[model samples]
Structures are given as C-alpha cells and as structure tokens.
Target: MRNVRPWRLVAAWVIVILMATTVPFPSGLIETGPFPFDKVVHFGLYAVLGWTVHRAVRAGGGRRPLSILAAWAVGIAFGALDELHQHLVPGRDPSVADWAADAAGYTAAFLASSVLARKSSRKEQR
Candidate 1:
C-alpha cells in the first residue's frame, strides 16, 4: 500500500462509478419502496468518491481549501452527469433527490476529513 498512488485510487473509483451508472437495470428491478435504499447507496458511493478525490488533490500539492473545493466540484459535477446519463439507460430516470444525496454525502465526507486532519495536526504540534 505504501507505493499505491492516490490518483490511481481516484481513477479506479471513478471508473467503478461510471460503470455502475452506465449499466441499465432490468425492468421491474427497482421499485419505489417505503424507504429509498438506492439513495443510501448513492450517498455511500459518492462519499468514497469525494474522499478519494480529496486525497488525490492534496497528494498532487493542492492546498487544503483548494483540495476541498476541487473534491466538491468534481463530486457534484459527476453526480449531475451521472443523473443525466441515466436518462439514456433503460428503466432509469434521473431524480433530483438522488443528486441531492450525492452532494450531501460528498460534503459530509470532505468536511469530516478536513476536521480530522486539523485535529491530528494539532495533536502532532502538541
């Protein structure tokens, strides 16, 4: 893992997301249930994507704020694109709710990472 590159992780994750979104679900595969499990899945996936993008940006010498912004921009833009791409897939319809979940998840992950990093830096200084 020591030699593993952060950008590689980001690219791999991006590919996974792209493949997942590109595939069309079978008809009747997804139903609007009492609870939306798919939103949770979208959130979790975007969270990981956000974290990876943030790490990659930082590893590439981006400053903290810049890294966070880059992660947010990439995550949200990708989410929007994913939603649009779904329109072309059979049995898939774009939803604003799903995009909202993606944005929320990305923001939560990046902010949490930033807070944790600041805390760890303070600890190291002490």
Candidate 2:
C-alpha cells in the first residue's frame, strides 16, 4: 500500500482529529455526570477507522478478516489507555464504565466488518 497512501493517511488523521474534537475532553465544565454512551462512541468510531486503515494498508493481501479483529483489539487497548489518560487529565476522572462502552463499540465494529467481508466474499464467488 505504498507504505501509507497519502490520502488514506490524511483521511485517517482527519477522522482522528474530528473525533478528538467532538468527544468530551473534560473541561470540568458542569460534569456531565458519567456519560453512558461515551464508551460506545469510542469503540464505534475508532474500530472502523482503525479497520479502514488496516484494510487500506493490506488491501490485496486477502487478510482483511484477521486484520479487522486486530484493529478492534488494538482499539480496546487504546480505549483503556485513553481512559487512563483521562484520569490524569485535570477535569476528567476515569471510569471503567467508559471502557466497557469502548468494548461494546469494538464488538459492534467487528461484527460490521465481518458482515461486510462475508458479503464481499460471496460476491467474489458469484
């Protein structure tokens, strides 16, 4: 994949930047009081983005399924690390609930990728 397609990199970075801006970063402003949906947001956005980058990098390798799983796993670890970082942030206190939400997001992404791969594989046979 040319070590990294410039456009895909830009896309990924743009996604990351967009997500970073949108997600709550904890300004300690009024304490939204434990967002239940944050974890899902973490997983849903990151997993797809990570999988997209992985697929882009390995497009012709015929190894997308495994790569997608790895992307989700990496995202899980990242979510954990992210939560930890939040703990260190001045306005944010880390919560395991957030991490659980993250996992749920990853699972959702994984299922979505699997479905896509399955349909594509079937198309290839037809």
Q: For all candidates, what are the clash counts?
A: 0, 1
Tens-place lDDT digits, model 2, residues 1-126? 344563366376546735563455656444355654555555566666555544553454545557655656766787677667665555567678766766676566556666786789799999
Highest lDDT, which number?
Answer: 1
lDDT of 2: 0.60
Q: Can you write out model 1's per-residue Cα lDDT over 1-126, one digit (the tens) per residue?
A: 333498899889889988988888875455468667888888998899888776666666665676568667878998999998999998788889889988888878877766776788799999
Error of 1 at 110 (Å): 1.3
Q: Which residue runs does candidate 2 get wrong by more than 4 Å?
A: 1-3, 6-40, 50-54, 57-68
Candidate 1 Cα errors over 4 Å, as ranges: 1-4
In the order shown, the candidates' Cα RMSDs to the true structure are: 2.8, 4.3
lDDT of each: 0.80, 0.60
